[model samples]
Target: MRVALCQIEVGDDPKENLQRMIDALRGAPEADLAVFPEASMVRFGNRLADVAEPLDGPFVTALRKAAREHHTAVIAGVFEPAGDRVHNTVVGIEATGEISGSYRKIHLFDAFSDRESEDVAPGAEPVVLDLAGTHIGVITCYDVRFPELARALVDRGAEILAVPAAWAQGVFKEEHWTTLVRARAIENTTWVIAVDKAPDRSRPPRGAPGGVGRSQLIDPMGTVVADLGPFPAVRVAELDLGVTERVRSILPSLTHRRPELF
Candidate 1:
């Protein structure tokens, strides 16, 4: 299936960010699915309360509308408000304008001294949903650093893993981003599609040290089919699901593993 990754530079204004995503979607070619990066609809530096919105709020509604208009499935990230706290969540909208499913970021970005944990609650579950004929898993930002989470999704029949990350600009970030993403795909033996953000000069950049733009698509064999550089752009790539079975058949690592001893 053909997937489109929309790599956008988010500004301080939520409305402008949302509009830019919509425009990006319009420019993209017809694909079975489209993915956006973490907080693509809003800047990440704003106060948690100010940016938080319900799962069915305007941002998600607009995304659903866009999906229906384009007749394609969409997976985008948003700050989901629940009761007194908020969570970094990814909402999926089907081409039929139906809310498919949502995945909250289990691994919170706590390495930053700013205390992301103090503002957003972490999710406990991994979500896998149907996209066309494939079962896809959803994860966000720091979650990519956790291999166990990706393995769990693969165990649950995920053929492709989607990551929406706001990787900061810092020393060796490009290498880390590429390395870790390929590692996840190679280990899980599934397709990996990571949609990362571009540096937004309008907003104070992420305090953490790391470069922003490094969106990539990796095949089951850990081959990078496309690399969308650190800039505002869109990348489209075709992922063959058949290759997944072929790779696993040749490797046969999943069934050959001896899990009891570690």
Candidate 2:
């Protein structure tokens, strides 16, 4: 399967962000899957409640239309209304423009002096979407730090992990992001499609840049297939599904785990 990683700079306006996403999809190379960064509907450091909408809202509805028009499956982040707070969500749309599934971030961003749980509700389940005969696991932003979630998704037959992040810029933050993403791919022996937001000057957090873009696709053996630097860009690469089986045959780490002891 071919995948397109779209690194875009998000803004505070939902309509503008939606249009930007559509434009990116329109201009991107034709692929089976296209991914965008977290909070693609609106950037962070702003009131999420102001632009939070349901799955059936205009933001996602427009994305569905764009996905159908482009004939590419999409997995992008958006905020969803959840009671008084909002859910940090990643919605999966099939190439046929149908809703595949949604993953509300199970692990909220509570570290680094940022309190995501204050305004965002935590999710209780891991979601995997079946698109074009491949099972893709959905994880958003901070959830990439947790290995247990990725393991659980692999256990549920996930061949590829779709990671959409709005990673903050700080000292050693870029290294942490890259290391964690590669670790997940190597440990789980699953393909990782990590797409991060581009540097945004309009919406910086704590007087620093919001996203340090190094969006990449990693193979099961932790080999980076492609990396889009720290800027707004889009790149498409072919994903050979058979590589997972070949790597597993050599390493076979997942099969050696002793679950009873842990």
Candidate 3:
């Protein structure tokens, strides 16, 4: 499948942000799927309570329209209302403009100098959406730090991992981001499609830049197939799923696991 990774700059306006993503999709290479960064609907670091919307709300509705117009499957980060706190979510829409599914970010960004737990609720399940002849798993930004979650998705028959993140910028943070992304792909023997948003100057955290926007795609062997630098950009690449089967056949890590001992 051909995938387009969007490294976009977002702002406070939901309408404008949606348009930005649609524009990127329109200009992308003929692709089966188009992926956007985390918080694609609205700007990140905003008050979750004020911006949180439901699955049928305007944000997702607009995304569905874009998917139908482009005739490509779309996936991106979103915020959904869940009780008192919002759920950091990733919603998938098929080329037919139908809601595929949603993944609520299981790991909240409660680390470093930020506390996402204060505004967002943690999810209990992993979401896998079948599209373009492959099972694509979903996870949000901070969850990339955990390997167990990626393994769970692989166990559920995921050939690729989809990550939508607004990765915060900090000391050694970029190093950590790239390392974890490659590690997950290598261990799982699956392709990784990671899209990150550009730095938001209006919403700096701890007196520093908001996010590091280095969107990239990694193959099963931990080789980067495409990388979009820390800026507003979009890149497309054709992925061969046969490579995943070949890598897994050699390593056989999943079958070699001695679950009883662990």
Steric overlap count per candidate: 6, 0, 0
True-structure RMSD for candidate 3:
1.5
Rank order (by TM-score, best first):
2, 3, 1
Q: What is the lDDT of residue 168 in candidate 1?
A: 70
Better of 1 and 2 by lDDT: 2
Q: Residues 45-138, candidate 1, lDDT per residue (tens digit)?
A: 6665677788678888888888889888888888888566688888888877688888988888777454678778989899998765678898
Residue pairs in candidate 2 whose N, alpha carbon or C atoms collide under 3 angstroms: none
List runs of model 1 lying over 4 Å from the truth.
Answer: 112-114, 202-211
lDDT of 2 at 242: 98
The collision pairs in model 3 are: none
Name the candidate, 1 or 2, with the larger TM-score value.
Answer: 2
lDDT of 1 at 39: 77
Report how far off residue 254 is in candidate 2 (Å): 0.6
Q: Considering lDDT, where higher is better, how would the candidates rank from best to worst?
A: 2, 3, 1
Instruction: Name the lDDT value of residue 91 in candidate 2.
Output: 93
- The deviation in Å at residue 225 for candidate 2 is 0.7
TM-score of every prediction relative to native: 0.94, 0.97, 0.96
**How far in Å is the alpha carbon of 238 misplaced in model 2?**
0.8
Question: What do the candidate models score in CA lDDT, each in turn?
Answer: 0.82, 0.90, 0.86
Q: What does candidate 3's lDDT look like per residue over 6-56, in tens digits?
A: 889977778888889889989884989999988887665667778889989
